[model samples]
Target: MTLVEGSGCFVVTDEGVRLMDLVGGIAVNALGHCHPEVVEAASAQMRRLLHTSNLYYTTPQVELAEALVASAFPGRVFWCNSGAEANEAAIKVARKWGRLHRRGAFTVVTLEGAFHGRTLATLAATGNAHYSDPFRPLPEGFRQVPRGDLAAVERALVDPDRPGVAVLAEPIQGESGVNPLGTEYLVGLRELCDRHRALLILDEVQTGMGRTGTMWAHQAAGIVPDLMTAAKGLGGGLPLGAVLVSKTADCLEPGDHGSTFGGNPVACAAGLAAISVITRDRLFNRAAIAGDQLKEGILGFRAMGLPVADVRGSGLLLGIGLSEPWARELAGVALQEGLLINPIGAATIRLAPPLVISDDEIELALEGLRSSLVRVMRDKGL
Candidate 1:
């Protein structure tokens, strides 16, 4: 779809149809499309400075790094352009740390159904074979275990001859479907990583910046990871990604990694603005409350005798499970009805609207979803 213009929670297409953007650009537009604060900050920065070699530090870059460290993670932050680059840097961190700290150990343990990035190494790190298969001979040193299976993680980490360096997994696998790991598993994963001396890498690429009702999803579990990657909504709408390392695991040395447009001052400025709104408005807490409302509404679809089988995920990041493989059809119908959502796998329709969306907007989205499902069912003669 070609979007010509956008505002908070809505996008206008070239065809003149306005859509309530429940997808949030796949969970990237946290404050909604073209949020005024974010746009103003980026515009102001673009006036003074836009891009410069990383040879010199930019104020926005340093300010964001400081803010992140102060509230989120403690170690240094590596700037990047997208979630892919963030995860790529994360994998590199694991590889470097493994070689330096472990007995040349470099394997990264990943969870099944995880989607890290499209980059070759990150693709290999991604557990879904379909994404990695197109590019054959994927980089080695990555292993996959079932999501939330601590015993499997333990087994994957126990190879002494080729020790594991890190375990990278999403707290909730967003792309495959909204499959959430239990809080128990998340805490257990941290403990397992500690026991194995392996870094725990939480890919908050889709869940960070108040998406999961927390600044960082790992925070909700009350367990700090050795390293983490965040992007998606970090820049409000701009392309900005960050790899946050803990103080003890801040191992990336100078000359080890760099990105040409990694921390563009303009993007960092937008990030600062987004962070400001997120913090000042307490969007994290707001997301938790709003998410509960949304999930409750979706679950009500079943009571209405819709095809909805389940409602899953935390915060605004949610997926509605259809009893049949009609999510793609329902999404198409919803788009025609001016509601935008994403279908993952065969049966789940994912909704990742802006964190600042109103309750009325949630009701609107729910209505659109219900209408779409009803229409699709009728057409299918179900």
Candidate 2:
């Protein structure tokens, strides 16, 4: 659909159809569309300055960095333009940190089903053949192991031939259908990384900024990653990303890396406003409550003999598993029914609604989803 404008939890199409935007720009619109605070912040920053490159320090950039570090841990922040760039920064930090600290060990061990980014190095870190096959000759020094398998991770990290200098992972895998690695597994990962002396890198690109019911998803496990990357909803729909560097893992020098539009003044301004709203209003808790509402609602469909089999992930980042392989069809029907949802492959529907979504909007989403499900069932003669 050709979206023309957006307000709150809904978007208007060129045809004037007001559809509930459960997709939330794929989880980028933290405060919903056209949030006045974000608009004013960006406008105010534009009036003062727009782009100064990274050569000079802008107030928004410095303040945003300070805010991110304050929220995550006691460390520094590296600004970037997207999730891929953030992950790329983390990868560079890992490699440099390995050289300086891990006897030149360079391999970064990632879990299977993880989605880091599309850059060559991050793609190599992702270890997805479909995404990496066409882009052959991917960067080396990356290994993949079974998700949630601490034994496998320990084995890879201690591989004497080419030891892993870091362990990179998502607290909950999003693009691969919202597979949560569990608190026990995450805590185990931290322990393994510590025992092996490997930097723990948590890719919070899709799960950060209150998307997963917390400031950062790793907080749920009570583990602090040596390096953390954040994006998606960070800029309140503006293009911005950041890498939070821990005190021990802060290894990048002045000339090690840079980005032209990494921390644009306007983007940082919007991000600061977004973060302020999330923190002051405690939208993370709202996300948790809304997520529970949505999850319970979908699961309730199962009792009525609908296709819903399970709900995965936490907070707004949810994956609805269907008992049948009709996710694509269901998504199409859902769109026609005035709901916007993402379908992962054939059996899972992804929901990443705005944190500001109201209970009534959620009910609308559930109603639309139910209608779509019934239509799909009827059409398929189920």
Q: Which 10 consecutive residues of model 1 have the lowest summed lDDT?
A: 65-74
In candidate 1, the residue pairs with backbone N, CA or C atoms under 3 Å apart (3 or more residues apart, or in different chains) clash, namely none
What are the root-mean-square deviations of the candidates from the true structure over C-alphas? 1.0, 0.7
For lDDT, the strongest prediction is 2
State the lDDT at 39 in candidate 2.
Answer: 96
> Which digits, one per residue and each the tens of the lDDT, describe model 1 over residues 1-382?
7989999999999999999999989999889988999999999999999999888899999998887776686799999999999999988888888878887789999998889999998898886778878797888899888877799899889976656889998988898898888689999999999998999999999988888888888788898988889898887789999999887677898899998999899999999999889988999898998899988888888887889888889998998888999988988999999998899889998999999889898889888888998899899996
TM-score of candidate 1 against the unseen true structure: 0.98
For model 1, the local distance difference test gives: 0.89
Clashing pairs in 2: none
Task: List per-prediction Cα lDDT, in the order shown.
Answer: 0.89, 0.93
